[model samples]
Target: MAKLLMDLTPLSYSPALRRIWLGGIFSTVGYSITGVAISLEIYALTSSAAAVGAVGLVALVPLVLGGLYGGVIADTYDRRKVALAATLSMWVLTALMAAHSWLNIHSVWVLYALIAAESLFQPINQAARGAIIPRLVKPRLLPAANTLMMSVGTLGMSLGPILGGVLVATLGYQLTYSINVLAMTVGIWALYRLPAMKPEGTAEQPRRGGLSSIAEGLRFVRGNQVVGMSFLVDLLGMFFAQARPIIPALAALSFGGGEIGAGFLLAAGPIGALTGIAFSGFLKDLSRQGRFLTLSYAGWGLGFTAFGLIAWVFDGQGQGASVRESLLRLSLAGLALAFMGWADALGGVYRSTIIQTAAPDHIRGRMQGLFIITVVGGPQLGTAGVGFAAEAMGAPLTAVMGGALVIITIALATVRVPALWRYVPEPVPDTRQIPSV
Candidate 1:
């Protein structure tokens, strides 16, 4: 209804954005490679959804813990150092994972421990990444920047599973994990090239208590209804509807075999997301971003419902449908997930824009830190929830239930927090002054 796209006349580009974007591309590829390898490795060894779920839970503590302290550190110290340290720590974890796999030490406990430690550091890196964006790109170009980031990430997501599948199926887990370690080292080198980013205002006096620092961030978000609602919607949608953690189990029982099938199925959503981001250049003039955010949540809910229904179709196709059927069904599910991904990208763009425009510079790092927590925590929560449900009710029901929850929660949000639909930022003029991708 709105014009499908506006002309790209006013957009400008940046060296800072390009460097950061390239670094993000490399980091994401490394992250995606490791994600697929580790997930497949654990599933291959234990073959239990609950055991797989343990990985999510193990990461949960450290992820949240890191986010809490990471925010404090981001605000109190040089953000570049905090991010670099966390990035280096993840490289170490990848090296440990490589060593463990190569030595034939297949202990699930050790894998969990190493992954949890890595997960903890991950959020610190994430917080820094979030804080860095405002500095690299101008406000008017934020949506385009988010789209670019998503596009690059989608590229990584597309490659991770495909490459991880090839490596795991042909070369084994050791080689797959080793590749991630090497990739992460490259990411570290890129990270080292980044300039230091200090907090925007006079450094807040070093706070003594962790809880106090964290509470300050909470207070900032809570006082702003728009930012608060945006986070709530994202948390509710993702925590309920994200279905990746259970994909391996679904592949084994409902589809066929493991590893390869699982990897393909897992790669579907992000590939779809990649497609959405690629065309997002068209959405530069879109308005009513709050409404877009709500609709995107609704769309994600509907996509989840479609995912559940398609499983039935895939199941009914019988054995003859194996190759063609899997591809078709996976494509449909991927399309559905891609829609969800688009919604997420739109919401993310709007949310980031709102936070940047509204929040004071002094507290931006702390604010972004809490935002990182929400973003990371949601999927982890979804993973654990879906994992448990898959173990109890099986994959289809888990999908259905999660879908239903997302829809229901969003419906409630639409009515109860009616302000979310009304929230909109002042429109930026297309001007030579604004920075571009």
Candidate 2:
């Protein structure tokens, strides 16, 4: 029973790691609150879902640019400094957002401009912080540490939005934004306490943190089969298997459950993620991480495929019997989504552990940056692709096709990049070997 529970090895191993993890969760909750407030505030101002959606559009370019360049910055300077700078910038931005709300400045464009700035700095902070984690813990514990950090962050993402909706509804946006500012202080302190984490290669290489360096990072990933496949595989997995955007359509047209049903389907994924994270203790012993990751990701596609099949087979159960039919349908659909979320979270844990263990320290910032870019971009593309497909073939076929493609793509990748399938890791951070120039 103990072996099946969530691993606490990393937390018990290092007090600093635990502090940073808790601080990160606090900051994540705060940002999530601001995220919901921003969306709601924009909707109120423009009364256009499209206008509200433009918030992502505003952040898109900056997210890529920051993610790339921010990695360069992290590699070039003291990572703690980079994190501190970004955190302070974010703090001021949150304060300004509060000021905007308190002063009742109802301009949508103003909101767009603020969101754009915030988007840029956010990635810089993320890149620096991600780069710092490997320096704090042994390579063997990376998976456990990541599980703790990611699960809490995911928890915050799940709870924060609901809390944000409540706060925005009752206490108003100004106060909510202020609370975000306050929430950041702990993270700020965490970053401040972190020791200097300059890229180890900086001393010997003395390379400029410029476009050339960024290109070099890109070339390394392209040339390195294992690391490269990690990114590519993750993109493909998320690209083909993501199911969030199709939930509303499935709820209404397929299940006949309307808004209430949609709400249950929506919460299903997060609940599954939390449950899986809680019982991820067995993951610490897995040696063939690549195969584990591949299998978990495959489960994600299967779960979505199951969801579509169940919804299509039931087809308007809510309209027929109301009680037994609806209960049975909601349970099935919810179970499928819950399964999807579990698979997604477990795959992510392995993916992160792979990158952190596989990559060298000096270039880890850039690798982590590329990860952030994939994280931001992959789901957006996946959702857009799925939404278009759903419009044409309806829920059942679209999901099945999407899941099929995900499975096929991964199988092909394992064939091409056999190194990924055979990969294993040493138990400690490899500091003796320098990165290739």
Q: Candidate 2's residue-wise lDDT over 1-437, tens digit each?
A: 99988888788888778888888888988887787677667656654444544565677678888889999999889999998999999999999999999999968888889988987898898888888887777766677888997887677666665677567767988898888898999889877887777887688886774788789889988887877877877788788866655665565556654434544565577668878888988888888877777877788888888888887797654553432446678788889888987887887787887776666888888888888878765765575567656666665788888888888898899898887778776555345442221
After superposing candidate 1, which stretches have Cα over 4 Å from the reference? Answer: 1-12, 203-209, 316-325, 428-437
Model 2 segments beyond 4 Å from truth?
A: 36-57, 96-113, 164-178, 244-267, 309-332, 384-400, 426-437
Per-residue alpha-carbon lDDT of candidate 1 for residues 183-271, written as tens digits (9 for 90 to 100): 77666776677788886654546655678888888887788777788888888888888767777666655554356666777777777
TM-score of 1: 0.90
Clashing pairs in 1: 12-436
Poorest stretch of ten by lDDT in candidate 1? 2-11
